[model samples]
Target: MADPHIKSKMDWLDYVTVIAYRLGFTLAAPAILLLPWEVETGIPAQQLTFLAAMLCASSLHIYMKNFRLILQAATWGGLICAIFGFPLFGLGGAFVTLGGLCFKEYFCFRVPGLRAQPILLAALWLALVLNATLTAPMVVQGLAALSALLFLVTAVAKWRMPLHFDIGDKTKYEV
Candidate 1:
């Protein structure tokens, strides 16, 4: 088994940027934290959930040592945020949550060549500008959900699975 981190080719600055981006996306995922800042129900549990989510996001971002995983989490977080927020904050929340999608697509993946970066950045800016539209915001929840689902499916497919099992050795389990 080889170390996958070496294949990422991301340096310290990339890691730092990714961590900050992930933190921002995760923080924006839950609407309660973004607006009003009030506990409508399950105050204790909500507090715990919020803490756990932030803690887990940080832990995963550091421990996994993989940028893609953080991006996947960001996509899912975006989906949850967009869906929950669309009902409450409408267009503004959707636009904000779309940042998660932008993080996952633009920041996480490499452009494969140096010539493409400027173009990509321009496209990213265009994306942000277009996100302000009411039409784009209306589809944020659905798009976020789709992006998250695709990321999950790709993750599962790429994961290594165990080949051998002990199910055939029933005799050894006899008590």
Candidate 2:
């Protein structure tokens, strides 16, 4: 029998990924309220949040052959766009990656509130980008708040799960 006390390299990677993932969302949850301060101080909370999120996404170990690769590509593509001054595309790509993660979590664990995350995140970004008069500022804020809460809940639940759960069956992974 495998010793439970023995921590594999995958275990360490999962712990680190979870920490980064949680930190990213924790920073993001208060983003709407912090926007004014971020703007005033030029702290760039949005960039930092995305950076951490990218790290988490890039490091994730998916059972499928190419799913993790696809996610990392999308994440890098988004981050590069943001760094190159394309904020809209950058945010869209990053959120899509995050939404993908949420979808994966929902599929794997059937976590409540996760299934709506992708739609909610997409809508939130679209409302901000379009600046639609029909979508009031308060509505945008409300969406942001809702998204933040859902993300926080998901992150917390993921953190609480067993480290080995993230690793899954190594034999099933494509080498």
Candidate 3:
């Protein structure tokens, strides 16, 4: 049986979001790894292998959409860790979350819908990415926290959502 909630149409907007999401993640994943590496190792010349692996993993979401949700979650988690952890714990903190993300996304992404909708995730990704380089840290932290909250709320709701969650549709829970 197929899941009703899963839709993979070829809408133009989907193309835009998918491209942006994939490209952004591809670029971001390497930085997520390399930042701490450079911080500790002072920029190794042979880091391309790690970067290539990250790129491959990022692109895997396209063919294997089931685990994409988990991947998305990890992606956000990485952003959170890198943005906040980098400043707080330095290299170790950054690698901790980044490594956890890669491990989970690579091994456990098929666990279920533990991720928010792709569209919402894309917006959050944009928020984290754009704000990550700002001069002010507080603003980025605030946005990252909000995005994580939003993702969690939507994800939980998605899992526990009433069957008839369509727009204004009423369900037994209302009665």
Candidate 4:
């Protein structure tokens, strides 16, 4: 069988993606660390949820060097946040659900062309809007928007290449 693993066509866009990925992680790290660990009834569990979300976002960004793993982690993480977070953080959890949608679209539409990027980007936009509306902190809202934009731009710039590079011939999952 021929190998389906597509090598990244190294270019400025690839470099930009790496940088953007790193930047997203950097921004998400503080949010992860600062998230509240506990909450009282009647008080919004926003801090704790944000912390968990930040952890997932930063962790996923770090491990996203592998495309398949990135997809899986993002999907699972997003689902977890949506299911567990909604009760705890309300609309904030919905934003996480939207993020999962973005990651799913990114993997599902992985094609050797530029079309897949916009779909994924649209998902990111949904997430950003949700976050902006739910979270009161301007810093976090700004960071989330900037990170989403950066990743979207990076992915769009390299839409004609495989989303990640791995050498193999097995079909672990189909995009």
User: Against the hidden reference, what TM-scores do the models get?
Assistant: 0.25, 0.80, 0.27, 0.28
lDDT of each candidate versus the true structure: 0.34, 0.68, 0.35, 0.39
Residues 1-175, model 3: lDDT tens digits: 1132544344464344434423433443334333323435666411332332233334333333454444444544444544564433222222332233333432333323323333333333344345446435454344334434433333343344322221121121121
Q: Report the Cα lDDT for residue 163, model 1.
A: 12
Q: Residue 17 of model 3: what lDDT?
A: 41
Global lDDT of model 4: 0.39
Rank the candidate models, highest lDDT first.
2, 4, 3, 1
- Tens-digit per-residue lDDT, 32-110, candidate 2: 3333245557887567657756756755767675777776677788889888999767877777777777778777767
The candidate 2 region of ten consecutive residues with least summed lDDT is 1-10
User: Positional deviation of 33 in candidate 3, in angstroms?
Assistant: 9.2
Off by over 4 Å in 1: 5-56, 61-133, 136-138, 158-175
Give me the overall lDDT of model 3.
Answer: 0.35
Report the number of the highest-lDDT candidate: 2
Q: Model 1, 58: alpha-carbon shift in Å? A: 3.5
Root-mean-square deviation of every model: 14.9, 4.2, 14.8, 14.1
Per-residue lDDT for 101 in model 4? 29
Candidate 4, 158: how far from true, in Å?
2.5
